[model samples]
Target chain A: MNHKNALTPWLFIGPAVLLLIMFSLLPILVSLLISFTDIDLIGLGNWDMIEFVAFENFIALFQDPLFHRSIFNTLVYVSIGVPLVIVCSLSVALMLNYMSNKLFSFFRVLFYVPSITNIVAIAVVWGFLYNMDVGLFNFILNSLGLQNVPWLEHPFMAKISLIILAVWKGIGINMLIYLAALQSIPRSFYEAADIDGANKLQKLRYITIPSLSYATFFVTVTTLIGWLQFFEEPFVMTGGGPLDGTMSMALFIYERGFQYNEFGYAAAASLILFIFIIVATLIQFTFNKSKEN
Target chain B: MKNRFEKLLITSALLIGGFIVSIPFIWMILSSFKSEREARTMPPTFWPQEFTFEHYINLFQNLNFGTYFTNTLIIVLFAMLGLLFNTMAGYGFAKFQFKGKEAVFIAVLATMMIPAQVSMIPVYLLLNQMGLTNTMSGIILPGLIAAFNIFLIRQFMTTIPNDLIESARIDGAKEFRIFFQIIIPLSKPVLAVQAILTFVGAWNSFLWPLIVANDQALYTLSVGLALLQGQHSSSFALQMAGATVMVIPVLILFIFVQRYIVEGFNTTGIK
Candidate 1:
């Protein structure tokens, strides 16, 4: 009976552990292995054809201009998009705190709807909205007696457009997160600030912002990681088009692995992406730690 | 005067932001009912002069969106079962004090940091090896028990009072019975939260489905919509119709249960 009790826990967790190992852990190891080889579609068919290239893929990837462009695009994306999302969400969350519950819930749903919709669908609508001739933005410009700006057609504008789409889909969850953190803040801190004759901005700076450091940190890290792996919107909206303007690292990797069937090179790119994410996350954590100190 | 001014400021800000935020959704729905020409017309009309369901009919006729919808439902249902299995494991971790449990939990948590992009190709290859590629099971297999979902369930289960489980144990209720009956029933709120999120996630999932399912019949709605867009790049109305089909179910679900969805993210953000 004691033995059975001991085994019961494993019985419960066994299936999940097994699946996690088979699907996640093993794949992670295999991907690392594959990154070192020339594992194309042909090698996928015949294991014997797989040749160990030992960082040759990585070496080749570094020389690949598209890979550099993808990395640069990803950095530009994460740098701009993450902060914009954070600031927007945090501002909305702060304002939300001042509203009535009934009104708050209404606005919450409005902000969150885009995030919940499929990116493919959002991309389609945005495509119409960004259409040069008949797109909504250009239409708005025409109505205002302004020359229509090529939104997705121009490389710089395409990156900005994709960033805008990302922030639209990303802000809801982060806003909700900030709201959660704000509500958890003790009321006395604000009351004390008020008694001290602190202005709203002063109180927000001294009290609210400091109080939300953890939420802000978590949001920053997660959103950065998300932006780093950005793919769908660019894929759907631009197809990484107009000279690979919106081609993200993740999309580049997808094109390599799936479209190009350069699985080994894709694996190498994925590992590099993985390393960048880890480094970024670690930097954020260290930054947070130093600030706390 | 000052308080009223501040209130007005906040209200206007929220209203303006809300309008901007809701534009895509409003456009998707309104454009779905427009003629293709009107949808693509310059200075795009805010309201369709004449509403039409032709695009809706066309989506089903040409795109066979119904098959994709059914395919998504199958994947979602199977994935839900897998989520329940994950929840059970979470319960075990929460209640049972077993050796190596902390290590296992940490291991699960650590896996969350490794982006799916890294493991995706290898996993796809593995699925191909198992002859699961291009099948619904292929989509369902890797997602069967996500580490993050397990972590979420564990966090929620830790909150369940131990007395109920202890009493059931005293009565000689089997471990599985206690888990299924006492623990699960008490965990309805979190379970509902997970259910709503999992549903939205599975429905909106794009990349993996795009990679795995080559058969058009087995394509999920998101993938199918992308395919529709590729095939009819200029048919704004038809694409909006496809987008509508994909968005409406989740949008409706959000309207009904958004509180749980918000609370879920508030507590356990894809952390």
Candidate 2:
């Protein structure tokens, strides 16, 4: 290393490092402290009104039915949503990579357009599609002599509606990742499989799936982490939904923090969610490690 | 011939896939031009029989979308500029060794796992104290120092041969000169990748801005759109118009930067 290296890194990184610590790291540390104190946004100046609350916020959250419901809904959303998104994306990816025709390239762009577009627009348009009377879905059902289903109005259906939109918005991205992975799988393996009299389906089953497992794991874990923090779609579309069927952990935290100004309680809830993500990440990392061996 | 049938099958699959994907976009644009009454009809037509720009006009007047558009642009530009400076620091971490470098790197990466949810209140409170609330700087300050961006640039810098830097040093170049003249010149691909990722991120950001930029005039595009929805309900045409407006800019950006966008993810070293 050059002699300048001793002085250079600090000189280069000093400003950024200071900023990250002060703006990002320091705030979270401050939050951990605030989570243990009953500090509301009454514009803090004197520390007289604030006092240590200990595990009271967490304890209260645990007792609250909304918190429990939020946890349940978050899990259900992640469990179902992640897999569906993965499958949809992976399928489209495979198809896009099945051949390099003009049409395939066009399909790639088509599938990806949704992923790149504004998600708020996606949620808004979907809200209309899920409208009970005016929606095209009901129109199709009515014309087909079937009963009109309320996509967003009902509890279970509302969850499904949000899932459908989420899948559409998300799948295109996962598809591209899977497509990239698919491209890297060696052609020689397929040639050998064909010579060994393996059919297309058999080759795909043995070769494609196993080869893409790493990408699958990566995609699923990231998607799950994102979904666990689900806020926008449900917040916009359902507003925690009919009978609290779709309240997610992130939205609940947002509501408690911003709406109620119950800072400590929200902080506790945020920590709980943070811990869930960490545990989930650890489990997946360990799983990948074992698979590697 | 048998090949003809195979081609037909593949072509059919592509057509169906394209249709499924493009329907929503087509519907979104189509519905935006329709009157609210026509838009809510059960049988959704592919196009408006009588087109109107009223919804689009209404958005500019009612929601103050021009300010939002400007706000998003300013935030995106400022964040990019801030990150460009940070990229210099990231290169230092990898290429320039110094005291406590490893510790600092580890510290930054460790903070990635700490979710933004926990940081929300304190950052807001901190900015409130500093009197930066409702300003673009408030939104941009926390994001200016990105651990991930630093890590990314550091990794990319490590890939450059030490011999190149050594030769530059042998030529009697100053430290800053080598960084600007040598390292920066060699780092185009990664710089493009980083810029696109950062741009998209700043453009789509919602939650932080939602908390900080409380005033309607100060609202960013995503926040503004959310507020537009809350303030005016049942104006399907107006919302679609607003949604379309919000989507177009990023869609245009993606079209130009598609290669860089994909390469950004590719550079993650997932394999």
Candidate 3:
């Protein structure tokens, strides 16, 4: 290699490496430092005004009922949202795989629509759908001679409503994932099952579900992590509630740092969320490993 | 007879499911065209009693939809710049020999686990210090180099045979020429994947734009729509129109490039 060529690789990778360091790597440490201090709007303006109060923000977070509520709400979202996403997406994938006509391809595109559309727009449409008096959902209920349900009013109902919308929006990409996995499973396995006189249910149980284990794991982990940081839907739809019923950890962090100007408090809250995510991901890894063995 | 029955069963199930899935989108578009009085009717009409474009006209005239659309386009355009930089890095990682290359690549992959929320506060502070806050650069800069894009491109480029580059170099091609003339053309499939994914992500991004652009003039479509929802909570037709305006472009884009977009997602899941 020539002298000029020795520097060629750095020329290629320099800009991306610099950016990754600036926005991602450095900020992780900076976030950790900020979490240890009391940095507010005034502190942001004047660096000297910031006070380093170690663990105080975390201590306060532990005692804060609102933070507690946010954590509980996040758990509720992940628990319900993750499973519902897996089941719905997997079922849709299995159905799509059963038929390979033009109509099925069209259905695949239709089902994938919500995944690509802007979330704020979807939230607007869904907000009207969840409207108490004249919403389509309530309209259907009343048409059947039933009372109107408060989709986003009652706290539990609000969580359920959010989960329903989430599942609706979330199933598409995962369904595609499962479909890809399904296509890759060798046809000969099914041919063998047929030779053994396996029925549809028996074939699905012994062959299809086992073949889909990795896709399911992938879908579950990604979906679980996504739900943990859930913010946009609740932020846009409920503004964290009729009564703080939908406050996710991410939204709580935003409300603290930006809305309340409690940057340090919010940083601490975010770090806790970060720890929760890392721990959750690690647990999932070990669990999946055990299942495989 | 049984085979035909099974086909009928699956088709009906998919048809019913597709309708249920599309109801909100259908309702949004339908309601956007409804007259204001009809939009608010109790037990809402399935079809508009009187279709009109008044809400869309109002959105353009009064709501600053033009500014929001322009801002969103600018962000997306700048974000596409990342594809070039990432592809360069991906090519370097895939084809070139360097010290600590594996370590650097693994580090890039590891950063994917760190949530954007973790760095968000400091990034805001960093931008404020740099005097970029509330500017288009503020929204554009943080997301300009995603690790995932670099990873995707590198994996794709690895499959291109190294002999193509070696032969071009033997014919007196310089390093940069080899990359631009030889490698880039071969990498089009992955580049298409990267471009479409980047365009969709940048266009639909909300939280970063919301955080960085406190100025209403700088608000992108997503933030603008959220603000519209807040400001006009009772204007059912107006909000629906705003949403339709935002979604129509994406839906159209999907229809045109649905294959590339779907394949891009499948690669992410299966790879």
Candidate 4:
């Protein structure tokens, strides 16, 4: 290539590459470095005051009860939310795929509304629905002669409530992913199954389910990573409240780093969360690979 | 008869499911129109006892809705600057042969795995050092060039015939001219998809803006609404109104561009 031609490409890409390095690439290393130091708001103003106490923050994070609670909460969220989202989204996709009517298309859009809407708005609305006295959920239960349930007040219930909202918000995109995958499956496979006198359930199990494996894998990874860093729902809904019932690792990081000004400690917690995500993702990849073999 | 029954069963199931999925949105919009007393009433009336725009009025008058809306618009609009630069980079990657290209592209892709939360604290500190904290630029700067967008655009551009660019070059056309005159027109579909996705993401973004812009005057709608929920904890009507105001624009945008958004998801699988 000519000198001018070689320079031309750099002209186009240089600005973005610079920004990416400054903002994204640099920050990862900086945050990692920050995790080892004893940095707080005061230290931020005076860098000399920050101490490089190696592994101290990490060790403290492991011992801290609040950190333990956040980890457990995040685990509960992923464990419940991932499977429920996949199953529910796939089920909805299957049901929608069975019909091709205009009404069903409308329903497809309806289901997707939550995914696109702002999470804070969703949290606020759901918070009202879960309100103690005049909430719609309790109102319905009262009409049926059942007692009111503490949706966000009880620690255990708060976790479940967050998962429910998360699943609802999450189902749309995964459903569409599955729907796309489902639509791509060749009809001949199902037709052949039918010709062999295979019932609907058998066709679904043997043909449809097997065909959706890749889409399932995709959904599982994305949703798993998403729920692992579960923050916005609980952040807006509970503020990790009711005795830290719904404190996600992401929220915990935000609370420690920003709320308490414990930047190094929060950085340690965030790094741990990042490691958990990478490990979880790698585990899924290994399991999928093993299954394929 | 069995076929008809099955169809009926499927439709009813979808109908019930759709209603259940829609209840939150339904409740939000309906409650936004309800008076404070009616909104808070036990065994809450599904329909407003009386239609009222008072909460919305209150949102604008008392809650600084106008400032929040304007701030959100500024951030989203400024963030679109990334799209231009990303498209240029994507084209460079797709069409040009350059040294260390593979390494650079892989580096960009690797950054995607590092979740935003990891970098957020440092980014905040960086902004603080630059005296950008509490500024709209602080919120807009970090999101200006996403690796995913560059990746998406490059993938789309690779499908464009190289012969078109080569012929332009043979005709003594400059690279920038070929890009603007020939390549850009062809890449409109991908550009549209990126623009829509970027707009939705910037509009709905919360945590970063919340962290960066602690000044109330700089709050985006999402951040403002979250704070509103906390400040007006008992004001159901006002909170619903704030939410309604925040959600309506995106919903309207979605209705118009629903096709491209869904198509974007199908093609990219990133949403």
lDDT of 3 by residue, A116-174 (tens): 88999999999999999768889888989999999999888999999999999998889
Per-residue lDDT of candidate 4, residues B1-271 (tens digit): 9889998998899889898999888899999999889998876888898999999888899889899999889878876888888999999899899899999989988887888789898888888999999888888898889998999899989999988888788888888898899988998888888898889888998877889987899998999999999998999988999999989999999888988866776665442
lDDT of 4 at B132: 90
Residue A137 lDDT, candidate 4, scale 0-100? 89
Compute DockQ for each candidate against the true complex.
0.70, 0.61, 0.74, 0.68
- Cα lDDT, all candidates: 0.88, 0.82, 0.89, 0.90
* Residue lDDT tens for model 2, B1-271: 8767877776788688778777677777888999988997757776798999999988887669989999999889987877777788878788766668788889888877766776887888788889988887888887777787888888888899999988888888987888889898888778887787778778887877888887877888888888878777788888889889988788888778876656566675554
lDDT of 1 by residue, B1-271 (tens): 9999999989888989999888878888899999988887665678998999999988888778889989889888987888788898889889889899999989888889889889888999999999999988888888888787887888888888888878778788888898888888988877888888888888888877899999898898899889888889999888888988988888888898987877776555442
Error of 2 at B131 (Å): 2.3
What number of clashing residue pairs does each candidate have, in the order they appear? 0, 0, 0, 0
Better of 1 and 2 by lDDT: 1
Positional deviation of residue A48's Cα in model 3 after best superposition, in angstroms: 0.9
Over 4 Å off in model 1, which ranges? A1-4, B264-271
For candidate 2, write residues A70-164 as lDDT tens digits.
Answer: 99988888888988998888878877776886667667777887876767778887887777988777887888999999898888888888888
lDDT of 1 at A152: 95
After superposing candidate 2 on the true structure, give the runs of residues whose Cα lies further than 4 Å from its correct spot: A43-45, B1-7
